[model samples]
Target: MTAMGKVRGYNAGAMLLHWAIALAIILQIAGGFAMMHTQIIPDALRFTTFQWHKTIGLLVLALTLARIAWRLLNPPPAHAPMSRVESGLAHLVHFLFYLLMLAVPLAGWLVVSVSPTAIPTLLAMSPDLPWPHLPLPAAWKGEGVSDLAGTMHAVLAYSTLGLLVLHVAGAIKHSAIDREPSFSRMMPLGRLPRQSTAFLAVPLAAGLAVAFFGGGLAAGRLGPESTSLAVNAAPGESAPAATGASAWTIDKTASSIRYEVAFSGNPIGGTLGRWDAAIAFDPAKPTEGSAKVTVDAASIDVEDAFVKSNVPGPDGFDVAAHPTVTLSVDRFEAAANGFVGHGTMNVKDKIVPLYLPFIFTESDGRAHVTASVVLDRLVLGLGLQNDSTAQWLGKDVTVKLDLFATRAGAASPQS
Candidate 1:
């Protein structure tokens, strides 16, 4: 039998495709919203959803194209001719659906192409296919392409949802009121009427699996490498001088490391400020130096509701009072991938010992540092869990620091 419905309508092939694409679209919609709304889903789950959305979007576009081609080749079963108003409405609706089906992915593709976020090529696959961005050899200069694409994608999503609702409502009206075999137009063939729950269950199960697994893979292990940029060590010259080489003065002009903080229950999340942390080292000796950092706490512009509400940074690292958080490095060690330094992180009225594993690269007599630290929030008394609602906020807060400090002056180790 043909893939479209049975007699006088679409056969099984077309029907199955229709249902499959419908399931994919629904999964994409749900997953997209879920990921946007909360971080509850682990990274793996988040990645999977993103990949699934991309995959399903592409599938919808392909299936729509195939359906169109099939119609051209074999033609849709003739429907009872409608009045002028009905014909116009039907035509407009079908056109809009097709337009959206094609446009949604195109917008997404554009967004991904220009964005630093890598795009996945195959559905449910780990390998990513990098596509070129809009700057066309740096000619189409500006961030405008990426911005426009993202906005268009959001707009198309909502518009398509509305269209889908209208389409379903129209189908139900035709089936119930007109007693038209409209639903049958896309029904499978030879499948006994009122088939067991598997019809719905199988697709539903497959969809859920795909959504979960795909998102997990994408966000978790299977996805591409994290889109993190870093600065590495470059060639440099140094001399052995008494009292060690002079300290590299902190360079405020250099790009400051930036991070985005997310708490489980925090209502707000945004960019934290940049700071200049200088490092002193002996190029000739390699391992002889320290790191000094002074952060302008007042400049820390965060949007996390929890942090905002907890005046003085939970542990009273109050910017209004102290205005700065300082870090003075003691010693450094070379690691397999990078370097590590044991130091003290000083905040308002407290000096906490910290062992920071950091990456250091030297170029032009300057060092760049990118350090990742997961600190026990309880130690700093960032008592984020005050109420029942804040209970979800975990005790460990992950702090990732990426900084570039220039060579300033050197001082003897204070024993």
Candidate 2:
């Protein structure tokens, strides 16, 4: 095309980007509403739905930037002959669509960046392609910043709905009401007049788009791989050491330690992934020696992602500063159904009295044990700082232990 040539309709690149971004925005709006109102959706699908929402949102951001860059290099066809007021409204709505299309995703990213959960963003829901959070400090992840960003994200998203309606109405007026070839301008099968695209506009506009969004993502890579959320855990190879040897050797594969609490009237539970126990009690004697159970505070694995993140948070376990929670029992008393173990448990630097009522059944050389204990979160310094009233998080946490063990040695060596 010569310099004197005038563009008709949009170039191939511009049209492709325009439709791609439009489709993404529609998915994003629908997904946004679904994710926010998760109570209506099944529990198992909520996490996948959120990941898809983020994936599509970032897709919209990328395509929007590409569309802006393409529009710069290849200007659209001149507006169909229309009144001044009509053209002004079209330009205004188009400009806003571009603005919100970029701003909405950025705000959503902001919400994630400052979220106390510090949940990572994985592109295309692929764990391998992790998108870094903005290099914002972990200390800035307060409720205030998170709430503000969340509010902005939702507000901008709904605002785009208004702009979308206006844009489509304008296009329909020209195509149906005025009988102009407006929709064909962006249609893939439609033919357009020869258009001159400025190769010169490519470098400058594309450079800005890359520098702004790409550079930000690059800076994210330079920062922490992920937000800290105040969680610090020793490597998996490291575990707490037991104090005294026990008569029974634990079968780690068949043993589990679980904790449960109520969240918003729903039961939420998690397991202590790493733990060790030293027991000297004999099932035949019912109560004889001491027992110690040490838990890796960092090994908390909550079923809910949101609740999982908070477990290591300052208001929860504060795993960063307190790495382990230990419970030790020196005496056990025979009971009607089982036995009662009197102990003291330490959590978040707070030592509190702990009691576990357990049933023990032994046949041959193998023993089976089941224990359950209910503890007040406030007494153990758990969630006291975050929710003293237990409005959302329950005040009581119930811990249950089920384990299979084998008697390690003979009862007495008199051979």
TM-score of each: 0.47, 0.72
The C-alpha stretches of model 2 lying farther than 4 A from their native spots are: 1-7, 34-48, 124-126, 137-140, 190-274, 287-289, 299-316, 330-344, 349-359, 363-415
* Top-TM-score candidate index: 2
What C-alpha lDDT do the candidate models reach, one value each? 0.55, 0.74
Encode model 2's per-residue lDDT on 8-68: one tens digit a residue. 5766667767888888888888878876865765655666677778878877776677677
Clashes of each: 29, 1
Cα error, residue 358 of model 2, in Å, equals 3.7
- True-vs-predicted CA distance for residue 302, candidate 2, Å: 5.9
Off by over 4 Å in 1: 1-7, 38-44, 116-125, 128-143, 189-415
Q: Tell me the lDDT of candidate 2.
A: 0.74
Candidate 1 root-mean-square deviation in Å: 14.6
